[model samples]
Target: MTTIELDTTKLRADRLFQRKRLVGFAIPAVILAYLTYIFFAFDLPGLAGRANMDNAVTLVSDSWSHKVHVTRDNRSGEISYAVEGERKGRYPEGARPAWVTGDEVITIDLGGDHIVRYLPENRTEIEIPNFPLIEVRAEGRSLVTNLPDDLPGWISASNRRIGITTPEGRITLTGARTEVFNYFPGWELFWFTLDSPYHGQSLSKILFGERVDPARPNISGAMSDWWNNAMWRHKDVAWAIGETILMAFLGTMGAAIIALPLGFLAAKRFSPIMLLRAATRRLFDFVRGVDALIWTVVLARAFGPGPLTGALAILITDTGTFGKIFSEALENVDQKQIEGVSSTGAKPLQRYRFGVIPQLVPVLLAQILYFLESNTRSATIIGAITGGGIGLMLTQAIQTQKDWEEVAYYIVLIIAMVMFMDWLSGWLRGKLIGRKD
Candidate 1:
């Protein structure tokens, strides 16, 4: 009998080993099959072939650098110098950059021996260190260039336009205008635009030296100029950030308020009715399963794009989430505590207020505070769709394509805002629920 029992145990162990081996091999085989399907489905190789590395490099460079545009109208022969080609950043009348010389024939000295000369009567000349001199003349509605038939990759010339790209700068000649872009490090006019009195003054001089603006005090005038800067729009950014925070706060708190009662209705222990519990659970699933982005789009159409719409979207989505979580917490409550309250002849509402709430407070507050922090980031994305908050400014900056520095600034502010929310949530959590360790 002992021999038979041992033989039976050995047979079972061998079968179990075979089953485990089959599972291990099958899991990897399934994963490999899925990955193979995805590789062909995504067309990754075709995407790689179509990507432009030069444009990617230029976009990355533009994020950290600024460009000065020197444009001369071919028809009127009028020259203009501007930062990033914006009207607000245009140089004051009759004022040109130090690198440019000659009034009649404007000479733009791009560093590293690259020079561009804008002569009278729609004539232009570009000289690079190792390359031959390029001369282009714009007449009527066409561009005349001394470019070879077999030109290099950097130069693209046609009857209507001539484009030259170099390491130091880029020069483009067209029938309507001749433009030269000189690259420089850092964001130009970030602190103050050309119109501001404090444009060129050093920080130390502005703080301690004589008044720069004759009409107002040094510090106040400087502060006002920086705060209301037209180019950077500091005031607008601050207001947008405030709106984002307000959206997140309203959405998270409002969801918590609405979810608490719904949570009780969903909890099987609190609501004995099977139909009611199932309906509440289904409602929670429907709201949350749709996703916040979908809610944002749907609500935006109903209410129009605004912070309030984003707030309502967040509130609706989070209400479902909070209801589910709170219901689970309610279901796990100590039955002994509820029974003790009932023995004291306490009413149903009072029993819940005293017995159930104390137990669920920590879990509810923890979830709410955690969601508040997470929702802050969610609100930024929601605001972008709803056309409000810092996300709108970020989207606008990205759409411009030339305002990458502004994009970088907005990204920094968004990160700082998230960090601040994280810290605030942690503090609130600690205050409400005593720290664990």
Candidate 2:
């Protein structure tokens, strides 16, 4: 009998090991099959062919660099020098870049032996090292160019327009105008536009040196110019950032206020009515499951697009989430404390106020502060759809396609804003919760 019992136990152990081995192999096989299905379903091979790597390279490079435009009107024979080809950044009359010379001919030396000469009669001359000179003459409604048929990929020419792209700069010739773009590192005119007297002055000079603008004090004038900088719109950006913070604050706090009662209704321990609890739970699920983006679109139509619309969208979505979280927290509260308060002959409301709320405070505060930080980032994206905050500025900059340096600036500001919010949330949490080491 002993031998038979030992044999049965050994056989059972062997079968368990065999089952484990089969599960391990089967799990990996199922995962591999799912991955194979996803690879074909996503059509990754076709996507590779559609990707344009050269455009991606250009976009990445542009985000870090700026370009100055030297454009000439072919019909009027008037030439203008502007940073990023913006009127706000146009160089004052009688002033020009050092690299450009000759008033009559207007010689532009794009470093590395690549030069462009704007001549009379709307004729343009391009000289590239180790290559034949390319000449283009813009006549009324047509462009005549001497570009060879075997020109490199960088040069595109036709009877109506001619485009030359080089490492140093780009030149485009057409029947209406001839433009030259000179690339340079760093954001130009970030603090002040070309018209400002403080444009070229150093910070130390502005702080300690003699007044540059005779009409105003040096430091005060510099501050005014920077704050009102037309090219960078510093004032506008500051206001937009404030709007985003406001949206997050109003939305998160309002949702907390509205969800607390709903949470009590949903929690079984607090509310004994099962039908009411189920209805409240379904309401929470309905709002929370709809996604913030969809809510933003629906609210935008009702509220007509502003920071208020964004705040309302966040409020509605977070209300459902807070209801669910608060209900869970309520369901897990210690009943011993409640019973002790009840033993003191305290009323129902008093017992809840003293016993239940104290236990819920830590969880409520922690969740509220966390969502405050998270909703700040969400507000930025929601603001884009609602036409309100820094996100709208970022969207406009990206849509312009030429102001990539500004896009980079907005991205940096957004990152800094998020980091600051995270720090603020953690500090508040520590202060309110009696820091947990």
The numbered model that scores best in TM-score is 2
Tens-digit lDDT track for model 2 on 1-437? 69999999999999999999999899999999999998889987788899999768778888888899999999899999999899999999989999999978999999999999999999999999988998889989898888778878898888888888999999999999999999999889999999999999999999999989999999899999999999999999999999899999999999999999999999999999999999999999999999789999998888897899899999999999999999999999999999999999999999999989999999999999999999999999999988889999999998887788888899999999999999999999999998743
What RMSD does each model have against the real structure?
A: 2.2, 1.9
Clashing residue pairs found in predicted model 1 = none
- lDDT tens string, model 1, 45-121? 78889999976786789878999999998888889999999998999998889999997888999989999999888
Query: Which residue pairs come into collision in candidate 2?
Result: none
